[model samples]
Target: MITGAQLRDAYISASNLIGNEKQKVDELNIFPVPDGDTGTNMSMTIASAAREVSRFEDGGIGQCASIAASALLRGARGNSGVILSLLFRGFAKGLKDVTEAGGQQLADALAIGVEAAYGAVMKPTEGTILTVARVAAEEGKSAAVKGASAVEVWEAMCEGAHRALAATPELLPVLKKAGVVDAGGKGLTLILEGMLSVFQKGIVIPSENVEEQQPEVSVKRAVAEWEGEITFTYCTEFIVGRGDQKAEEDAKNLRAYLESIGDCVVVVDDDEIIKVHVHTDGPGNALQEGLKYGQLLTVKIENMREQKRRAEEEAAAAKPEKQRLERAEPENDVGFVAVSAGEGINGLFRDLGCDQIVSGGQTMNPSTEDILEAVQAVPAKTVYVLPNNKNIIMAAEQSVELADRKVVVVPTRTIPQGLSAMLSFDPDRPQEENLLDMVRAAEHVSTGQVTFAARDSEYDGHRIKEGEIIALNNGKLTFSEKTPVKAVTKLAKTMIKKDSSFVTIIYGEGITDEEAEEARSVIASKAGDNVEVTMVNGGQPIYYFILSVE
Candidate 1:
């Protein structure tokens, strides 16, 4: 049987291992489109659980699994993250109400997780994480049937996952053509290995490579260990009212007392109050020591191990939080939440009646919680979410179950598609009827993009070199060009049909207005007098121009 402590350490190890090596998995993506990194998304999703579960001390397997599943679902960031959450959600169900799990129970849970993951995907594909997970679960079940130990069953699963990962190239032609295994599958395999290490050796994988910025302060602070036994359990803080006239002179001795009992010690001696922050196993003892100086005014104590990663997250979230727009209560019958980046593109969505705009797109995919928050903020009985990027669609879909009000996902795969859907939405029409119209409108519009190659690669028979201009038609690589202007103009002419009536050139940042107008003129001159050609500044990164054709 696997104890709660064992499982908790295993989960933390998996999160840390994946988090530290996300960049390596990111490089396996051959597609030039700058979508969210699969490894990064998966790591963040599991780490959300790690942050929560780390706070629990010897919680039952059932309770820990439940907490992990809930956190994973809310924190899911992309298609990969959503799938990861689904897998864990199923795992949690299998282990429900159990303090510890035997080999058979663990194997059954793995099988259950695999089933849920497959069910969640609309068009479940082979040669992906789903395949790897399925094969691993099968191996685990086989090991359990042979009466193996819990650790033995997990080791078998890891071996099976690695084997499945190796075979992914043969199952997915894209991975084969790129000479790389499936990125998502590779990420899953890594997590399994990470967990196996802990199950067998009782050692959490260290995240030493993970950088933690040490801010210079007058007080000394120590970070909790990422692996092995944590030096301190509680992070205690308090304020003591000074009771003596010699409190200022005694402050030096107070600081010394805190250092003796804790690793991270901060004691600020003031004329009136002495503020202290320390990490120690004995919180009551520390408080007692503080009382000798004066009376305790305010006290706070937390698990220090959980604070390490959370502190890094707080620092990372600072910029996005400041940039995030405030959401409002529902005021209309239907409200829209669209995911996009850049001021201009966000403005376009906001102008189109989007009640809230989530700051994400190809560069970043917002978590399910992010979308859910936006959906709840809308002051409407019925809310519609526009993912606006194909990679973000699954994450947006997960929000449907979490949102309080009626939430609908339009399934828009591009910024242009999102805009077309918004234009098609008729407030006067029935909400359900408008959804069909919006989908149809989005389907009718063609999306063309001109962006630089993220890396050197051979895709769809096109040999693309890094830094070279590339054009894509509805998300497929078309051709390469010498300049952004030439690429946009050529792409426009190709996408325009004889029945086409309008063309809009949305120029991104780094592209001059002269170049945009020049491309518009060329497109207009070729498109004939009947086709209306217009241009706007999108100010988006990665893509030089986003062309919308109808």
Candidate 2:
């Protein structure tokens, strides 16, 4: 049995371990897309739990496990983050209401978390986190049955996780093609090794040499003195963890919870976790309630009014200094950053309160360094990042570690999800509550897109020819047609299904206005009478049309 402090230290150790080797894990991402962010996802996910575990008040092993579990869930960002959160959540459940956890309980907890993660995903895929976690839990269970101690069980789990991680490439051809293991799986193994490190060796803070912080401005400045023209204020941020309760509509319920607290909220939900952001007055209460569902991590708050006032003063001062375009020094309060592409998309994110936008997409993936600069540029107590593309999630995640201030990333896999997530923005709401709520709301949306095939392949029994327009429901290619409009219409029809009530079509660049309108009409006809259709100009490249259903 371990003490609460020991558990806390173990989590911190795990975080540092994963943080140190994030790039290696990132390299394992199978997708050739520039935004492969497996390492970043896992690191951010564990970091959320690490923050909670590090700050746990003196308590028994159960308390520590509970805290770690909650924090992991709330801080979960992508598929990887969500899975990591579940592993700990299961650990908490295994040790619930107990003073200390022995090897048996720990093993049980590991198994439980694995089950929870598998349960959450709509379609469980092997060769991913699920495989790594399942193997580790099994090893832990087998070791515990042999009268092993907690440390012994964890060691078994660590070894098992590594073994499983190593085998990921064998299980998935893409991983083999990419010449790497599963990024997310390796990340989980790193965390387990980190936990084991504390028990075997000792807590070792990542050296400043390796754990670099974003460079800070040389001079100290007033909180309200740095802004200019206050493009946006209220740099609100929080970390949310997953809750243990097996409640129906957990995501939807979380969304309702955030709605009660704030507005301007954006929530993105994946199989494993949810990421959220909002503008509201109750950042503290939001975080407190967020704890009920998960653990509390780092937080940041800024006064929007103060930011505006400072920006005005700076703008006035710059005029006297004869500075044209008035250098918009980063504010000292709050700031925002997002990952996106296209002028229209950038403008949309900016209008939604983002302070910085990193240009990226399916083709042009941003590197970790690009995202890191954006994170560092946002001069605030906390910085919020939105990785609107699944491929970019890892890169955006890596930026958090390189940043100086608190950083929370909302994993938005698609532009529709990104925009919908921001709709619930509430700077005043508690960060945790908003995060949970917005993420839940995002899950309600269904996404579709039309793009020309990049390669010839047989997917889901559909034969595709390169250069032909392909329509996708979510990420799965469903239709291949000669014209963009026909392909897009087919995707929109699939997106609506029977229950969908609203349909949105975002026309991209290279598409004529008449073609977009024609595509919309096809979807309208298929959607029946009650479904409403709305169209907009995204002016994005690549995809001919981005369709969304709610």
Candidate 3:
């Protein structure tokens, strides 16, 4: 039988092991795309659960598993992270109400976890983490049926996982072509091996290079000190769901009410929701006033003075830390949160009515927690989130469940699509109407990108050489050129249709203003003067220019 404490220790060991080997799994990425973050995503997802479990001094196996599953769901970052969370969610369900788990029970939990993972994915692909988990669970079930002990069952599961991971190359042609196994499978295998090591060898792997910590001040003392310096003690925030209420009027009234009681107030309203943030001594009065707007979501109250004191103490102890942004209640009806990189792009989104901009794109995908923080910061009833990248949509979607506000993801797969969606948004309309309009507008625009090929490869019959300028039309590699201007011109010609009227070119960091103008001139020469051409300094990395034709 495995105790809850033992299970927690095993999970910590697994997280540490995966962290140490994350780079190895990352390198196994077979996709030609430059961004490879499978290993990092999986590691962070499990690390979240490990941290949560460490806080529990005593609990049943079911209690501990549930805690881990909950944390994983909230912290899930990417596709791999979401899938891993689903697997653990099923495991927690299977272990529910059980204080201890035997070999047979553990095997059943693993099998359940695999089933949940497969069911959650729209199209379950083989030769990935799903296949590895399924095979390992089946092996564990077999070992349990043969009267194996808990440790023996776990050992068999690890062995099966390794075997499946090694065979992934044969199942996926892309993996074979890249001379690597599945990255997700490799990551899962490392986690299982680490867990097995704890049971079989009694070796607990410490987290990779973790520094020792110093703890001194108590929470009571911290709060007492905080009360002395700040006029307002409670930092309150909540989201109100719009239910047959006038968003604009209600938001204005709420802002007035909050301002009367507190400072640093922010009130944002939209067609479907209203978000409020304020620092006040009387949080109950604020909550009462918020109920008039709609049902409250994500009600949070913290002592700001306490947080400030903590930051000061950490700084005094020579520990460098980033300062937290001050929270203000929303004062608008509609709020927009956009994910973008580069100062120019951020400023553009801000100019286009975006309330908050999350700094992430391409190689660095923001986690679900990052998106959630951004969502909470926007004080509005209905908050629209533009992921602005295909890979980031899932992570952004996960924030909806965790947020207090009514978060509607606009599903913008590119920066151009995001900008077009913003342009189409009508603040006077309902959320449902705006959603359709924004999506339709984004769909009508054709996006193209020009970036240098990261590696030499043959893709779609095109011999792409490293450092060559490659033009991608609607995400497909269409052509390559020796120069960015030529590639942009060729890409623009291909993207421009008979009905296309406007061509917008957003130049990135590597290209100077002169180079951007030259590229725009080449595009205009090839595309004809009939099409209206515009240029903006995007200053983003990875791509030389992002083009949108509509």
lDDT of 2 by residue, 262-327 (tens): 755555555444565655667665666666656545466776656445644654465455212222
Better of 2 and 3 by TM-score: 3
Steric clash count of candidate 3:
19
Candidate 3 displacement at residue 243 in angstroms: 87
Judging by lDDT against the true structure, name the best candidate.
1
Q: What TM-score would candidate 3 get against the native? A: 0.76
In order, candidate lDDTs are 0.84, 0.70, 0.81
Residue-by-residue lDDT tens digits, candidate 3, 366-484: 77877888888888867899999887887788788787767899999999999999999998898899999999999998999998876667666677667788889988989888888
Measured by TM-score, the strongest candidate is: 1
TM-score of each: 0.82, 0.49, 0.76
Task: Please identify model 2 stretches exceeding 4 Å from their true place.
Answer: 205-550
